[model samples]
Target: MNQNQSFRQLWISQSIANLGDSFYILAIVTFIYNRTGSAAFAGLFPILRVCAQAISGLAAPLLMDRLRLGTLLWMAEMGQTICFGSMCILYFFLPSQWLIPAVLFLVFAISMLHGWAIPVRNALVPRLVPSHLLVKANSLLATSDQIVLLVGWSLGGILVAEWGVIRVLEITAIMMFFSTLALLFVKDPSANVSAQPESQKRWDRMKEGWITIWGNPILRTLSYMEIISGLGESIWAGSIILVFVKEVLHKGEDWWGFINASNFAGTILGGLLIWKLSKKIENRMLFTMLISSFSIGVLTIAFTYSSNPWFALGVALIMGPPYQARSIAQRTLLQFHTPEVLLPKVFAAFGTILFVTFGFSVLLMGWMADQWGIRFVYMSTAGLYVLSAFLTLMMMKKASRSIQTQKEERYMNKIE
Candidate 1:
């Protein structure tokens, strides 16, 4: 099959897997919460998963080259299936005290697989589609990602409420099993490709991606910007936002819900906007940086000045489009800038850096909010956004000058 057809099939399979993942997580969390009766225990799930994912992301660069992309994708899906099925068995057979640790362990395992799966999937996109289509493809895929998240979160809750957590587990496993089957049809174009010389040490293989990013001026700058953006974007953490609404706005829990919903709605709108304007958006990097910075400034202002919940909702709504647009633009830029052979490693390194920064930022911001105030944390994140923009702006100027200098040298050489 043609690459386009293959990508379409993979996309469908991924969507299914994404949905299944969402359901499985919710089901597991719900089960924990119901059993333990503690939001803290429920919250630990994400933290554990993120920790596992970060470690796995750090390891992905070394693994990606050794394994077939299609094989890894399918294996991830199948692994998840086994994990979920195991969870079901545990729920039925295991004693109550053993459940939490078992659940947490499975969550870590699933997250580890997911960490590698994401970079592999992203690296495959450029291979499947041409350079010209990258923006649109990324936009559509991101949109679908958000939509699947929305559907899964919404439907999973309802399903768990209607049927039991065990039933949800069973359903999630079935979905993952189907996803594995779908992946079987994806032919790995690079399967026949030989690996680098055996003399390449394990440490060297791991460092390859890091070196590639450091060696490329554009990628290096982009990495810096993303690192800052992660810190800034950590304000989106659900718990922090909820606290902000409750303590600062003196609003009810429902207001927190409203703001959260608005934020996600904005994300969905932003993804759609990017998909629609993908072709028309010239200078993707510059436009992304500018829009992102401006939007964060706007969000900061809204949070600082507005005590009205409705105005806060409006601000949340406005925040989604630029955030989604910037994400797509940045992703496209990475794919365009990085060589195809090194793309997997680049993505792995990027994901690792971003995840680690964001995870810590969330903790840091949460503490700052507790000690200082939520408003301070919000403003600080906005400042980081501005700083990142300024830094990227300088990098863009430097790149332009370098390009011009090369062009001038070429012209002079022709005259000689």
Candidate 2:
């Protein structure tokens, strides 16, 4: 198939897989809580999943170096499908004492495979689309992601209640099967077309991405920004948000859901705005990213101080566009700056950083919420955002000066 067809297949596969993921996660969390009657047990699901994904990301360069991106993606989906299908069977046959552990193991296994899929899929976009279309492509992908999250989570709970957990798992398995099938048509000629030298050590291959990030000034700066932002973004974690709704807003579970939905809606709007302004944004990615970063910092503070539920909802909605803009710009910048051969590994390293930071940040933010207040957790996150923005500004100036030096050297060579 042609590049356009391949890209379409990739997009469809991701959308379907994400929808299945939503159902699968909701089913598993609900099942665990219902069976155990413990919020702590249910919470372990995310904790385990994050840890597993981080571990997998750290090792993903090994696979990315050997397999085509298309192959890696489809295999990840297939592995998830098999794991979920097995979970459905084990639910019926396994003894009560063994079932939760079995299910949790399967969850971790599935998440490990997912860790590989994310970087592979992201690395495929630059190969499929021209550089000029990178912003629009990333915007479309982000929009679909938000849409899937909104639809899947909004409908998943109801579906689980109606269909029962086992049936929902079965349906998700089927959806994943189709996602794998769609991925079968995807082609990424840029990946794994040649064998690596036998002299390269496995340890060296694994650390290659981290080395690349360290050597590149832009990637290093971006990594620092992501680390800071990831910590700040943890304030949006469900547990923190739920607590804020209860303790600060004096609101019910429905209000929590409303706030979440509003945030999703705002992100969807933001994605559309980015898509519409893709050309302009493409030319000034750093500037756009900087502005969006500051906007999010300001909006987040506004969100933290609002006692009125409706006002908080509005602030959450306003937060979406800048958030989307910054995300697309960052992603596009990474794609443009990294070489095709190294992009997947670089993305893997970046994913690992995010996973690690987010995991720690969740725990840190949870403690702050308990010790101080939910408002304090958000206020501190806003401070982190401001720090992140200034860092980006510094990086931009350094990059500009580097470019000027290059131009002047070329002019001197011409004069000689």
RMSD of each: 1.7, 1.3
RMSD (CA, Å), candidate 1 to true, equals: 1.7
lDDT per residue for candidate 1 within 1-416, as digits (tens), equals 47888788788888999999889888888888999999998989888888888888788766677677777778877888899899989988899899889988999999998888898888888888877778888887888888898889878989999999999999999999988888887766655222577678888888788999999988998898789878988887887888888887888878877887787888889888877777786355576766677677667767766788888889888888878877888888899888877888889889888889988998999999989988998888788877777876787688789999999999999999
Number of clashes recorded per candidate = 0, 0
Tell how far residue 255 is off in model 1, in angstroms.
2.1
Distance from true position, residue 338, model 2, in Å?
1.1
Error of 2 at 397 (Å): 0.6
Q: Pick the candidate with the highest TM-score.
A: 2
C-alpha TM-score for every candidate? 0.95, 0.97
Can you list the residue pairs that collide in candidate 2?
none
